[model samples]
Target: MSTWKETLFGDPFAVEGDEIDETAQSEAELLAKGNVFEQPAATRGELWGYYLYYNGDNGFTMNSYMPNILQSLAYMGGFYYDGNTTAQNCNNMPEGAVCYVPWAGGSIPVASMLLYIQAIAFSIQFVLFTTFGSLGDYGRWNKWILLSATIIGCASQIIPMVWVNNDGSQWNGMMGMMCIALISYGASLVFYAAAFPLLADNLPVVRKARFDPNVSREDYVLVAEKWRNNVSAISTTFSNVGFLIVTAVLSGASFAPWEKYDFPDGVAHILGNAPIFNYIATVFCGGFWIINAIPYFLWVPAGRGGPQLPPGENHLTIGWKNIISSLREARKLRYLFMYIIAYFIFSDAVNTLNSMIGIIQGQITSFNGTQITILNLVSAVCSIIGCLAFLWIQRWFKIRTKTNLLIIIVLTAIVPIWGSIGIGSTKFGIHNTWELWVFYVWSGIFIAPIWAWQQTMLAELVPKGKENLFFGLFGVVNKASSWIGPVVIGAITQSTSNLWEGWPFVLGLFLIAIVIIFFIDVDKAKEDIRLYLLENSDEASVNGQEKSIHSVHDTDRPVSAKDEKFV
Candidate 1:
């Protein structure tokens, strides 16, 4: 029987407690020397729990709850004369809110404050990701490093719950928590995403593909992609399910009449039900992560880590050197660079759009906890639908990855384009409360699974070797543009005091990026990477054969298994 059958499909003769015999040439072989044969490895479900909880906490606690509370807190307290007020001149800020910051002698809007905070947060995250340089992909570092980052982010969620008050003095606390959450999240996210390849590699099915002579190279390549997409879609779905779980719980609490039972004095303080629920949700998400991560740590084996480090290169310098050298090589790799530039801008626009929506949702809904939670539930549900839906569309039509992305990008742009309509008039777009429902539903379905497709995009463009080096740069570029969108949106919203004004800028960004992405030819990119590898490849780089078996992890963390052939 072909080994591809075993790698592509599970062994019918096998049972639980099985370890791949690494001394031989099976798929589960590891490059590393040590193996604890007695330890029971994770079932696929156990492996999945990592994505479920980590992503849930990161997406909900950091992106959804954190920003919502920060903006609302600033709204409850942020105010001034020259910036915005209910006097209805500069824009639409409520009356009597305590002003937080004096911006050029005028107070900035809560929305602008949140946007600026987002800008700062991403900037800080870029630095952290740059500094770390995918060190999590090497041996022994991935598990500990990923857990540390997760713990830090989860720990910060507690700050908002216990410390924040609407007395206007709590802005510093919120800002501090924001920094911790954002930086930890950036590191943890790239770290988390880096685990996918290890999981796919360790799968009995994927492992067998390596030694199967019956399978043609082209067939194996196609199967490899199909297999990867399946796993990634599952991971993305789990993330959404985590989002769904968090929002559903919040919605249940919001709709319940819990306000009647509260007896504590000075608890709600200056803030109301919405921010309080958000704080609770944040803590809940943290707990959810802790509970889910326990299984991953206990059951997931840390595989043989990344290749041995280069001589004389430390973590910081190594990643920088990799990026710099890659850039030097980029002059010859046209399509890859082209895709990177487009992906960079497109990712930034998407991120800014998310923050912009959150702030704007708070604006129109008056920060009503019930409506917000309900909307969150809608988005979470729709995000799942989007992931499954897009995956189905891709599989059913057999559409190329680029085509799927193009379709998704065009559909996603409709949101900002529609919002731009609000800049001119209040009839349609996101101006009305009803429109908020549409926005969430639309974003959940079209925008949620974009990152999965994006991963596939980079994989297609990268040469056979140098996956880590180039992917680190890809991760950097994906997030590096974050500083641009939020700052631009913040300035616009700050100047106009109308959140709608920023939508135009976001729309232009989305449209322009989509255009660039449309023109990128993946076929041409494949050719470029192929020719580049033939000419420029060196012994320092892992060759193509080893590349197929290379275990990808930020450092072979949660998804890693102790199989030698995998690396």
Candidate 2:
């Protein structure tokens, strides 16, 4: 008769204080009575709008700007220190460089400067995530925060255009611009991720039907799980689509007519002659991001009143407290905590790869702009295929989430190994550019499902109402180690003066993640969250405290029905 018992076993025939009826209702009748098929049209529309816009921005940043920025920095650093002013060498350099290089005497090493910038950006992001992560849980400004961060983040991309000189010789405040842009981009992501749970919970359709009078607790859970899975899959797909579009556009722009067109002095100066395609492509991608993101601000509602703030504490105080509480609670949630550790390790490898791959390709393979664009386009296409395939395999075949993730982790491990050892080594005969292309495309296929699965699993395991707080914790775990990988890799590469050697560190991180993931008990983690919410629901209500619950969307509904009987 306990909550956990009812949840684990079906309670289809049980009614309040009444004997079970042998044939109370057919399964189809029960489903209809519960309104399981009543989709929330408005909610779906909002989700679609937000997902489309957000994913578009995400794609533009990842496919266009992020790579462009990192490559630009590397090229500029080379220009400054080595005085390599070749067309490819100066192609992506920041502005103001034409007026101000050769720094009087000496310049910092490119690798060292890159590592330092990464560290500073991630450190700032960690502080911001710690402070702003829980704002949505307490205040009515979630949407505003998301909007402002996104706008500023997008606007930051334009700074290089204005400040960097066209000639690739000098740029005023180039370092400052890079730092600000990174920080702003990082801040926007925290807000963007924090918004996911809200979107999942607040779908008017799900909220309305979740509390059907005739619905069994098990049935309700089934519905909620379906929604979570559907949303997660769809969101991921949209993100991939966004990446694909950006890649296609950029790749297409590399062709003859566009390549031959003469840009204005300011534009041409920012874009350089080595590969004029990148400059115009970057600006086009930035514009794409800003224009696409408008719908998210317009369509998504923020902070639809849930938990009240604790007495005498504002969101800032509560945000800090939430971080502390999550850390303290980690000991109690062993499986969840372990999973986070695993996520941190693997994520470090993934993040480092994303941030550094362009630099590696440019420096090691001497890839031209056309080649790079084609490579990105192939990767983007593969990513889309991977996401879609994952959804099919999971839904049609019904594989366990942990099992699928492990498979992905193992496959992903192959990439670093291939890159570090197989590519140019005598052992593998993969010495050609086409072979390298195959390896990269293989990597893209495996990497695409990682974020989708990771986010879905975290959503599955997080305590219900405190998504923002836990996601903040997720962000903390993520960003805390973000810079470490880059720093270690950069240090190793610089010390050895070999880019290939640093990649083994990435392979090791992934292997460690695989081992840790093997020990995580997903079912036990979900159970712990359910039990915790059940035990604390009453106390939270009486004390006017905020705690995890079944759904943030259903906060206004009676708790005794769902909390006591279902969750």
Candidate 3:
């Protein structure tokens, strides 16, 4: 009869006291042998694969829809020109609480309105993210939160069906509906806060390790360098994909005769229209989001040390105590704080640029809908390539964070110049539209890695066992900052752009962010991981001792006694 150990790890089994050996063993094996770090060494490719798919929809798919959604909403309110359709003018309603006509026949000052909305949305998301971020940490299942958000999102799209009229003006029904729709955005935060930490928890420690094991701890300092870069890329990609699709649709390409359908008045029309693709897309897209989330439940190990807070002592506590405790605990991790702050700054700029680009390209540029749509399609293809390439680069180069940051910085400096020129130019000497498309594609290569790096780094910044809390904070900052980027661009475009000057503010912000990126510390994070691993080695040695002692005892004891006991 084979021994249990023989059956598990295969053939000859020897437990080494080394830290690496301790991490290499599975949790079940560890339990059998009383080994700590019981969580198995997660395979490198497996961990990476899980996270890659998990996050694919997160920034790119969801956030990409932001500009388009807002645009649709504005369109329904009777805004015109800035890609406004006669179908969207909402100023002709009869007197009533619901019919305070907003933008009847002309553009509703989109840049200004968007700025205000984004600013408000930003603050709201921040509060929502902060409030619910710890749900996962406190041991709550996120599935319900996701489901609730999905339902709310679907319903929000339907509200427009009643308020929007054929003449492109809002009926009295819109005022009430807009309030509820904005409120619904909060539901998304609950889902994000829970999901981020869940992803972090899924990553194996080895996959999280960055620096060389030989490095010094004193030299290690946590910074947002690489993670920041990745977030920017991810956000940009999301913007790229959605904007590309919407722009393409508007680009004059005729929809398949059967592919088209009439949308009902109000919000439902915007949500379900040809360009917007209806609330069904929202439900399905959101459903897909939930589907991706399932693997985390199925495969990822639960957070160790149980919940971050004990029962009754959780966020439910009255008197602001929960809020204070959450803040205080979150503040303890200096690295995490730095990363979040960095995320706030750059994300604001990127998001704003995305919003501005959609509005400007759609309305301001003489480029027709077909041209805009074509450019966006090109952007999508480029983004996909860039995303895949970045992953390959990470694996092939075995590059350190500092090195990666340096590369990103170089690309950041160079690509924006090209992108800015493409956006700013009146003529490319050759239909200029194709030139913009080429630029969009080329720039995506540099932008695709931002989220991947940021997310992976954030996972590292989190305490080994408390990934939930760290990622909760991540979601808080990430969503909160989301509104800033778009608002800034909107405000600037509103104030600056005249017939003569173009929207240079977008390029200016990108440049400023690049300057900020230079100051971030990537090397320090790598060194920290190396030092932490070394310090924890001693605790790992007991596995070797237990195995050695047990083997010796077995050899010294009589074989006949062991056999008799077995019998």
Candidate 4:
């Protein structure tokens, strides 16, 4: 019958019941270790931690926004309409005026080329992320990856200024553009993989509010119930704002429209391309990296202590060794492996579907550039609302209720995929294009939480000592599976699907993937970090506070004679 406010301050899980002796428990259980994890009465950062976290999140969020912008342009240019031909359906264009005049006479295969561009980019990204994930584990400057990604993103967008033709087929220009994209995606993966391990390093298990050895099991469960609440706050207050900004850009007035160019609206414009948007992104990216770089160099403390390796290990050897070691460690955690499997299946599907949304709009309707952009803006706003709604739902359900929630999310995701089947077919007097937007909003709402929750759950599953290595392997799964989604749908659409039937097949697979979500163990996830913290903190106290915040190893544990000397 206790209110949430009272529950927050008073331990409802008190083991000694109503007469719980906090002092005696402190003495017997080696507790007053609370002081070991003390915060200052107040600090400038504490007052501003929320703001700082927003900045960090915004930095990463801005980093993610680059891909959406590039993809938005690509989808509209390559898939929705032509990037190469005469300007059409607009007030400013001459009747037969051509776009990208340089490539006007050349025969260009646009769709295949774009696919190749994406495939090659993703391949490079996979390799870079694998390497960066390893580096992040062993305590390299992970934040630098974000800087690299931002620079590459800006450079990629800007490269079109020199290379693209007004006609759609700037073969050389496209190749150069693809190369820049490769570098950007590669760097972005590195940034993404590197950022993940920070949670393990910076946030302690007790601070996570999921575990305390001095408390009883019921109280621990009570604390675990708040895990989703914290993440929900993080997602809504930080993550949604980024989604809003990016979506706004995509849905606003078109930066490069097909009407100003020469050919059919869907053709490629290889030359005489407008570069204003690219310049804006480049400037923003430069600012983003410059601002974020200062914090990495100044404020953030290095927890792993300047990256020590056992004698013969440096970047090359250590990097390869780290990958192999991470893979080996991953094999040991069955729970993590299962989650990785489920995540890959679900996330890859989500990515591919999101990537092609603009194209879907273009194929079904004669919507103009501004409308396309605005629709995307609407989608972004809707997505933020969807993400926030999901988090609110999660908060409503106690942490232990995750098992049921996962069942519902996974099950609900299937409906959009199923609904997408008739999306372009037009069943109820509505054009397929309008229905496609509805389906897009529907799927986005259901699936937005899956990404953040999966990461949070993975963080829980990771053991204390192996957080970096485990998450590194998690990155491997993420990148490796990324290509599969795009390749599958792209291939299906290219080979078998007519203008009518292709999207439904892709939707079916999305529906099929939902069944696997039921197999995952949310109960284990809820208790995992709590269990890890309780175990580690107790051992640290028992050993007379010998534990460094970074490293907590037991000195008294018996080791084989041969291995003992290494420690």
Task: Please list the Cα RMSD from the true structure of every candidate, rounded to 1 decimal place.
Answer: 6.9, 10.1, 14.3, 11.2
What TM-score, over all chains together, does every model reach?
0.79, 0.73, 0.56, 0.61
**What Cα-based lDDT does every candidate model obtain?**
0.64, 0.59, 0.42, 0.44
Per-residue lDDT tens digits for candidate 3, residues 1-567, read: 546453332311121232343345446443332222223333333333334323323322223233344444554554333233233333332211111124344232544554556566557656654555445334445545544654565455454544323333432243334334444545543444334322322223311321223322222112112222232333334434433444454333323332344643532322223543322333344444454445534553443211346446555442135445545654654455565666666555455544444444533323232344455556656667776887788779887553564465356445335445544454531124554555466556665455445566555555453443344445555566666655655445455433112235544655565555555465664466445444444445654432121110011100000000000
Put down candidate 1 lDDT per residue, 1-567, tens digits, no spaces.
346454345432243334444345423433321121222233565455655545454356666677677766665555455443343322244443323454457667677777787788778777766777557655457767777887887788777876544664576568768877877766666777656655554455444443354544455455445556556545655665666676777777665445543435644422235346677777887787777666666656655244456667677776667678877766578877888788888888887888788777776765566677777778767766787899998999899999998888888888888888888686776877988888878877888767767777877887764665566676667557878988998888767767778888887887887888888888878877777766654533555433332322322122210010000
lDDT for model 4 comes to 0.44
- Model 2 alpha-carbon miss at residue 57, Å: 1.2
Which candidate has the highest lDDT of all?
1
How many residue pairs of model 4 clash at the backbone?
38
Alpha carbon lDDT at 264, candidate 4: 63
Please give the distance, in angstroms, between residue 480's alpha carbon in candidate 3 and its true position after superposition: 3.0
Q: Top model by TM-score, which number? A: 1
| Runs of candidate 2 exceeding 4 Å displacement | 1-48, 62-66, 73-108, 163-165, 171-175, 196-204, 210-232, 258-274, 299-308, 364-367, 390-399, 422-432, 456-471, 521-548, 553-567
After superposition, candidate 1 runs with Cα above 4 Å error: 1-21, 24-58, 82-100, 103-106, 163-165, 195-233, 260-275, 300-308, 394-398, 536-567
Q: Which candidate, 1 or 3, has the higher lDDT?
A: 1
lDDT, candidate 2, equals 0.59
Error of 3 at 368 (Å): 8.4
